[model samples]
Target: MNPLQKRCLILGASTRAAAQSALYAGYHPVCADLFADTDLCTIAERLPLQNYPDNLVEQATSISPISWMYTGALENSPEIIQAISKHHVLWGNNAEVVQAVRNPQKLYQVLKKHDLTALHLREFNHPPPANSRWMLKPKRSAGGREVTVWNREAESYYAESHNKDKLSTDYYFQQRAEGKNYSALYLASATQTVLIGLSAQLVGCHWLNADNFTWCGNVAPVLFSHQPEKHQKLAIQAEKAGNVIAKEFGLRGLFGIDFILETPFLPSSFPQLFPLEVNPRYVASVELFERAFDVSLLKWHIAACESFEQSQQEEFVTTENYSANFSAKAIQGKAILYANCTFTFPLTIERMPNCADIPSYGRLIQKNEPICTVFATGKTIESCQKDLQERSDEIYDALKIKE
Candidate 1:
C-alpha cells in the first residue's frame, strides 16, 4: 500500500483494532509493530528507530507520509516524540502531548498545579518500605504489562529489575485509590483541539473479586450503574487536564486520557473522581465503540492532526450514530493470544451492512489468532452493557483455548 494514501500509521500489538481504525477512516494503514502478521494489509515498517532516540524528526523521514499516525505506547518524555512527529506527512498528534500523560510523576505535578486531585503517588528506585503495598510500573509500557501491586518482598524483586534497567530509585509511588476507570478521546491541531468521542473505559476492575489486584480488559460506554457523579467528575477532570496540556505542550492531533474515580467516603456509593493516569494517544477500545456508535472518530482525528492548536470548546467535527456498545477481551492463554487480543469475549457481534452468511460480520474464524471480534449497539448504555455481557459471556464460555 502507498504510504501517502494512508490515513494513519498504527503501532503497538493489536492488529484487528488497528485495522478497524484504518477502515473507518477510509484510508490505508501502514503498520509498524513488534510482531509479524499477514492479515495486516499495509506494508510493514520498522518497529522503532534505532539510532534516533532524541531526534525522531530525522527517523520519521525514513517512512512515507500518513494523513495521521497512531503509534506505540508513548513514553514519559515528550521531547523524544516531538523529534519524530515533526517529520510526519500529516500534522497528527505530537510527542509532548503523549509524554504529559505517560509519566505518573510529571502528570501528578501538573494536575496538582491545575487544582485537580490526582492519585497519591511517589517514585523510587531503591527499596520499598516494609509495611506499605505498592505497584511497580515500567517507566514506559502498555496493556498492564508488568504493572501490578507489590508487597514488600515483591517490591524487592522489582527493584532489582529496576536497578538493572537503570531506573531511578524514586520512580513514582501512588496511593492506590479504589474507583471506576474510564477514558475519553480528543483531537487537536496546531491552533485547536476538540473532544471527538466520549466513551467510558473499562480496566483495572478484575481486582474486585480476585486474590490479588489484576488488570482487566477494557470496554466502552461505561456500565457502572453504581457511580454517576464520580464518572462525571473524572470526565471534567480529563477536560481540564487536556486544556492545560494542549496549551503547555502545544499538543495537536488525536489523544486519549485515562482516569480513575476515587470515593472511599461511601462504601455503598461510588467513590470520588480522581485522575489516575493519562494516555496521550488513541486508545485500545476505540475500534469497538466506533463500530457501535456509527461515528467516524478517525476522520476528526485526521482533521485535528492537521492542526494541534485547537481547544476543547472548538466546533465539533466528528460523527456518531449511537452512544453505546460493548467490546470485551479474555486472556484464555497464549493459544488464543493471537495478535493483541482486540476483541476477546462478551461482545454481541453482528454482520456488517453487506456481509451475508458471514460469521459475525466476516470476523476472523481462524484459531491461529482470535476466533472473532463481537460488536453490538444499543439505544441505552445499560442495554448496550447488558447485551455486551451476554454476548461476551456466551462466546467466552463456549470457546476453549486450543492449547
Candidate 2:
C-alpha cells in the first residue's frame, strides 16, 4: 500500500468495477463483497466475509476510519447503511436518502407531481384487473431477483397457501411495461443534475444463464430508435426525469434510473419513457459508460459528494455534451456470464483477457450463479453484442476442461 494514497472502502455484491474505478481515480480501495475475485485481489485489498451482508457491518468496523460507499443490494438495507455511516465518511447517499428513493410509493408521488409517466404499482390488498399484465416484485430486492410475471391463477394458489395480509407488505404488483429496457446514468449535486450517458439493458438472457427477469448485462450509448428525432426526444425525457428525481430526493453523487422505452406502433406517435426503478448509487452499467467516454466515474462521484454546490459545473458532463461527444458508430458492452453447471473454476481463467469479477482459482461456483464478466466493443450494437456472446462462449468452453 502506498503511504501517500488515501484509502476508500467499497462494499457491494461485486466491488471489482468500483475498485478499478477507484484505482484510476487515485484511491487505494479496500473492498468486501460476496466474491473476492482474483482480479480484484490483484488491484486492491480484499476483506473476506464469513456471511455476506449480515457480517458486513462487523467487518467494516475493523477497518481504520476512511471514506466509504456502497453498490447494489446494500441500498435495499438502509439500516445496515446507517450503522456503517456512523463510523466512516460516507461518499454516497445516506440511509434516509436510500429509503426515500427505494420506496415505490414515494417515487410514484414524485413522478406524479412532475407530470412524468411512472410505472403503475398495485399493492397486495388491491389486485389488478385480471386481463391487464403485471409483474410481482419483492419489496426488498435487487438485480431482478424474485421478480415474475403476475398470473391470476398462480396468485390464487399462493393466496390459499400463504397469508395474504402478511405477504402484502413484502411484495407488490407493477403493471408490465412492454418495450426495450434502458438505464440512464447521472451525477447530481445539491442544486443540479448532470446526465452521464444511457445504456441498453439485457434482462433474462438465457444464453448468459440468467433466468426470469435476472439482470445479465448492458450496452452503452443506446438510442430509443434509429431515427434521430425519436432518439433525441427519448433522451430529453430521460434527462427531465433524472433532474426531477434527483431534486425531489436530494440525491448527490452518481445514480442510475432503470426505465423502459415504450415505443409506439404508430409512426406519428412519439415514444414514451416509463421510469421503472431508481438505483440510488453507482449502478452496474457505470463501467460501460466509463469505457465509452473514457472518464473515471468514481472520481466524479466522489467530487460531487464532497462538493455540494454547482461550482464545478465545467467539469460535469450533461446530456447535451454526452450526446455531442458520443460516437454513433462506436459501441461498448459487457455480459455477466453465469455458471450453467456447478464446477470448480480453473486457475487458467485468471489470465483471460477482457474478463472481470473473476472468481478465485479452484473456487466452487454453483449452478445459475455469476462466474465472471466478459467485455467487447465494435462499430455497432449488434456487432458489440455478438462479440460479447462469442467471448462468453469461449469462457464457457474453457470452464469445461479441468486444469
Candidate 3:
C-alpha cells in the first residue's frame, strides 16, 4: 500500500463501480461486498465477510480507521449504516437521513408539501380501482428486488402467505405510472443541488436474463433521437425534482432519482415525470455517466460531503460542467448478465475488455445470479444497446459449456 495515498472504504452488495470511481479520484479503496469479483480484487483490497450485510460491521471494524461510504442495498439498512459510522468517518447520508428518505410515506408527504408532482401511495388495506395499476414495493430494497405488480389475486396470496389480513409495514403499494424509465444523477451541497447526468434505465432486460423489475443496466444521455423537445422537457423536470428532494431531505453528496417519463397520448401534450425512488448514495448508474462524460463522480461526491461538513455553501460541481462534456449523439451503456441456469464459470474472464465484476474461475453461479457486467459505447443508443446485447450473448454461450 502507498503510505501517502488516501484510504477509503466502500461497502455494498457490489462495490466494483464505486471502487473504480474511488481509484479514479486518487484513493486506495478497501472494499467489502458480496461478490468481491476478480476485477475488483485486482484493483483494491477485499475484506471478506462471513455473512453479507449482517457481518458488514464486524468486518469493517477490523480495518484501519478511514472515511467510508456505501453503495447500494446498504442504504436500506440504516441500523447497520449507523453501526459502521461509529468507527469510521461517514461521507454519505447518515442513518436518520436514510430512514427518512427510504420511507415512502415521508417522501410522498414531502413532495406534496413542496407542490411537486409525487407518486401516489396506496394503502395496503385499501385496494385500488379495478382498472388501475399499482406496484407492491418493499420499503427497504435495492436493484428493484422484491418488486411486483399489484393485483387482487396477488394481494390475497400475499396476505395468506404472511398469515395476516394486511400487508406488512415492510412493504407498500405505489400507483403504477406508465412510461419509459429513467434515472438522474445529482450532486448536492448543504445549500444547493445540481443535475449531473440522466440516463435511460434498463429494467428486466431479457437479453441479460433479468426479469421482473430487476435492474439490468443503463444507457446514458437519453437522446430522444428525433424528439429533442421531449428530451429537453424531461431534463428540466428532472433537475427541478432533484433540487426539491435535496432541500427537503438535507441531502449532500451524490444521490440518484429513478423516475418514469410519461409521454401522453396526444403529441402536443408535454410529458410528465413521476419519481419512483430516491437512492441517496453513489448509485450504479453513475458509472455510465463517468464513462460518457469523462468525469470522476466519486471525486465530486467526496468534495460535496467534505464541503457540507465544513459548512461551505458553494456548489461542488455545476450542471454546466457535465453538459459541456456530453456529446449529443454519443451513448454509453452497461448490462449485468444474469445466469439462466446453474453453472461454473469456465474462464478467468477478468482479461476481457469492457467487462467488470468478473467471477473467479470455476465459481458456481446459480440461476438468476449475476455473472458479470458488460459495457459498450456507440454513436447512438440503439447501436450501443446492440453492442451490449452481442456482448451478453457471447458470455451466455460461454456459460453453456462445461470446462
Q: TM-scores, in order shown?
A: 0.67, 0.93, 0.93
Give RMSD (Å) of candidate 1 vs. truth.
7.7
Model 2 residue 77 CA deviation in Å: 0.7
Indicate the worst ten consecutive residues by lDDT in candidate 1.
330-339
User: Which segments of candidate 2 are over 4 A away from where they belong?
Assistant: 130-132, 160-166, 223-226, 308-329, 401-403
Predicted candidate 1 versus true structure: per-residue lDDT over 291-397, tens digit per residue? 54556666666665553344432543332311222232221101012222333332233321211111333244443333433444565555655554555455444
**Residue 53 miss distance in model 1 (angstroms):** 12
54-101 in candidate 3: lDDT tens per residue?
999999999888999999999888999999999999999999998898
> Which stretch of 10 consecutive residues in model 2 shows the poorest summed lDDT?
314-323
lDDT of 2 at 27: 95
Error of 1 at 25 (Å): 2.2
> Candidate 2 lDDT, tens digit per residue, 221-307?
785456788778777898999999999999999999999888688978777999989999989888877777777778878877885
lDDT of 2 at 157: 54
TM-score for candidate 1:
0.67
In candidate 1, stretches whose alpha carbon ends up further than 4 angstroms from where it belongs are 1-8, 36-39, 42-68, 74-87, 126-133, 156-171, 189-200, 204-216, 223-234, 267-270, 307-399
lDDT value, residue 227 of candidate 1 = 67
Which residues of candidate 3, in runs, are more than 4 Å off? 129-132, 159-166, 308-329, 401-403
lDDT of each: 0.50, 0.85, 0.84
lDDT of 2: 0.85
